[model samples]
Target: MSDSENPVDIFRGFLQVLKSFQILIILTALTGLALLVTNGMIDGDWGRLSGGWANVKIFLSESLPLDWQVIEARSYPVCEQEIEFFCSTAYIGMLETIKIAFVATVFGFIGAILLSSLAARNLSPTWLSILVRIILSALRSLPSLIWAILFVIVVGLGPLAGVLAMTFYTIGYLGKLQYEAIEGMESAPLEASRATGLSHPEIFTNVVIPQTGNHLLSQMMFMFEYNVRHGTVIGIVGAGGIGYFINNYLKLFMYSRVFSLLIIIFVVVVIIDLLSMAIRSFVNDQGDVRRPSWFTVLLPAKNAVEIHHGSAGEEES
Candidate 1:
């Protein structure tokens, strides 16, 4: 009859809190099996998949006919001299890739602003948050490559389709991140700004934005970096840029060129990541200098380890 009479009682209570159900597990397994059967991504040739992992024999072997020798061929663009010569000509397409990514980022940033505002748990009521969450989730559910493919058919094959896809895709992604940033924000500056009789828009732009500025910039940079990497791949579906070149080489079975393209992509993505990291670090450090920590105003020491609320003005409640 004492609390220690039955440990099983506590175990049952824990199970009740979890809403433990065998039916959910069974449903998950069933759904997984159905997806495995239907999705071509799961139709992986396990034996060759292991072989492919080692980078061998990806395509079926074939012999070219003697008539192929009659056609002229361009030499591989290599060497410092060739790089200098062709970098301008050859990389015009890559510049187009950069442009595509740039346009996409701008549109994506705008869309993210709107969607994230609505998605903000603090700014939005329960129903609005739920609705926008579902919409953002739907935007994020599809692969951007697939979106590019669909758009290529609708808009014709070019960077426009890729840009559009990246924009739409990033809206969902950045919206989710930015909304979480808004949710996790401290309320002190916000309250102070509101108490001054600032409008809601003014409070958001000045107080909240300054508080989260560093994180927001870092997130935006990360989104741009992510788009660059994905932008490299989407061209395979005829969206535009180097991916299209890669697909062309792939069609011709020019594995050497494809390998070269892969190398280029690797270098570019690494450079992009490094640049983003450096910029984010520098910007964050600088931002901290510009904004005084609203939470640390009453700290006893310069490097205070803890925030203790000594008055009603400090703590929320």
Candidate 2:
């Protein structure tokens, strides 16, 4: 049959047309959504865009008579002294930021572990799981920045506010991640554990924890890294961290000091990211149940259970 008269060819052409039409519809929908979300940003005044570009050009121009130059010229004579002060203050502020993130992550992870145990569908009772899921969903609905603002207002201010905000937010975030990890675990091992007449706690302490340990640790490390970055942002609202110094410098137009402090923050965040990567890689390489010695010590029974499971699998193979 001629191609145009062929039924298969006609059907194929129809499908191609339908695919293109579907794509066009999707693109149109996305474009409308973008416009709605941006609230006229995309189609705003051309004059404002021109002015913004002009300001950006002025910022980049070395010959511009900027206020920063005046400040630098005045401080040139005492540049060495200024460096010392910047270093000391920035160091202290960064340390405080790290402390806040660390404390928040530790407390949050602990809370997440507990809550996630009750939230996992396979491990927890239906009512308890549903309740925990609802609580977690509510917590996760708000951004960390919003939580920080509320805590700052309630607790007054300082690292305490930052810590509390990070803690609550992290619990929600980590709990969701961990319970997902638990639910995503291999059903074979869990079923085997259940068939052994083990109690719920025993199954969780053995099969659940061991099977998902790597995922839990990896996610926790990521959360800690995320909290470090978030801690700085929350400090802008007087929650007290390196961001406090950043805000102070920006307000005072101390661009040089601000630049230096930004570098410090960058270095700290990069170091944390690298450390997390290394630890995650190490855990992944060391086998499924591999974990830190301290973790093994804390849950010797879990480790033994994992070993038993491993041997059982080998025997089946």
Candidate 3:
């Protein structure tokens, strides 16, 4: 009957949890299999054909000379000369990449605020929260590549297409992330704001928005990082960036140029990582893992307080 000898309670709890999880797992697996079969992915013709994988490998070995060019034997001066083209194109491409990411992050951050404010379960009505959630979901359902492709068609290539595509895509994704962050926040401060005759909009601006700004900015940085990675490939769809260099060099079988462009991308990503980390460290106040979502926004209003009758229950334990 003692706590240490609670075998019956443990057995029943474990069995119920296991049974529930087993049912969920089985349904997920069956649905996955059904989708594969419905899509013809389970067709024997698709799997039975070994195709020309082996033949293609043999053909390449036969066609290409075994004693063909080596990097050391090829003119070192000529290799160095080729490297310059990659560096130049890659530098310009990298700059454009930064521009696209900046636009995307900025746009998404603004959009996240508006959407997240409306979607906040504590600060907004159920209808507003649901509407914001639906809008965010619709925006996020499509990959950024589709936006990039669509913009490429409308804008006719260049960084403009890349920027627009990345911007809208970021808005959709960040809006949802920020909304969830807001919902996960502690309700005490918001409730205090509400108790003081602060309107929903006022509570959001004074309490929720201020508290969540850092989390929002962190999400924006994450979105920016994603944009930097994705924006490069969007150029493949005629949205000008490093992907264009990759495509052009790959088509001509210029692995050296491709390699150089890849190096440029790595350098840019490294720089972005360093900058973002520094900014985050500077903005973060509490330095705790479980930071309140709206802490950054509240930093500015540190002296501001909402009078409440009894807040002892809500204080940190």
Candidate 4:
């Protein structure tokens, strides 16, 4: 039979066309739903959307010439340093936010590592994995803002509250990422370790961690950056950070000052993104999207070399 006329070939082509048509239908339905939601949100007043540009123009006019005064020392504090920027509200708030994020990320990373090990099916029993996943889901269900408000009420308003809130959220978020990474690991080493009667702790530490080291590092860095951005939200609830100043400025209708603080935050977040990229480069020679789990790391040197060459040879075909 000719290639195109073969029953298998015709069936495969039909399936491919059906798949493309299904994708197009899904996209069309999603677009229609989005439009419906937008209409509902505007209450049929689409004209309001046209006025949005005017409102934006007015906001820009009021906020432009970004206030450099925010970086100057406050009147009450009595500046101790020769450089005034150190004592400024912007600096103090940003520094506090960074500190809270750092501490929370560290604590959360440790807690997530423990919880994820238990949550991963490869490492723990099915019942234990489900229980731990339920716990993580509970933590993640409430956002950092709600957690911050709760902590603020319990601990009083400060960076301490921010730290606690972010820590809990980070644990949930990072635990999900960690356990998934662990579960995605190749089963060869795990099976071998089990056959040799290695302890759970030994298998986890010696086999699982090394296999997913790059993924763990990348997830931790991402969580740290996530926590940093969330600091502003938590701080708005009196959890202490740059967002505290931002909230105050908003209340006082000082848009220029708020804009200035946002600029500072943008700069800080950009720096953090760059730093995260650099740190991930240590484990991931490839880009962020292609973090291959290095399971061969668990094999003996000779076996690892053979596997590497074998994979490379296969790829050439």
Residues 197-314 of candidate 2 have per-residue lDDT tens digits of 9988788888888788779888988898888888778989998888887788778877667666666777888898788777776656556553544434566787866766676678
Q: What residue pairs clash in candidate 1, if any at all?
A: none
Q: Candidate 3, residues 137-235: lDDT per residue as tens digits?
A: 887887888988898889877888888888778878888888788888888887777778888777877777677767766777778878888877897
Where in model 3 is the C-alpha error above 4 Å? 1-87, 285-317
Return the TM-score for each candidate structure. 0.64, 0.70, 0.65, 0.82
Angstrom error at residue 132, model 3: 2.2
What's the CA RMSD of model 2 in angstroms?
Answer: 11.7
Candidate 2, clashing residue pairs? none
Which ranges of candidate 1 are over 4 A from the true structure?
A: 1-90, 286-317
On TM-score, the stronger of 2 and 4 is 4
Clashes of 1: 0
- Which candidate model has the greater lDDT, 1 or 4? 4
Best by TM-score: 4
lDDT of 1 at 194: 72
194, model 4: CA deviation in Å? Answer: 2.6
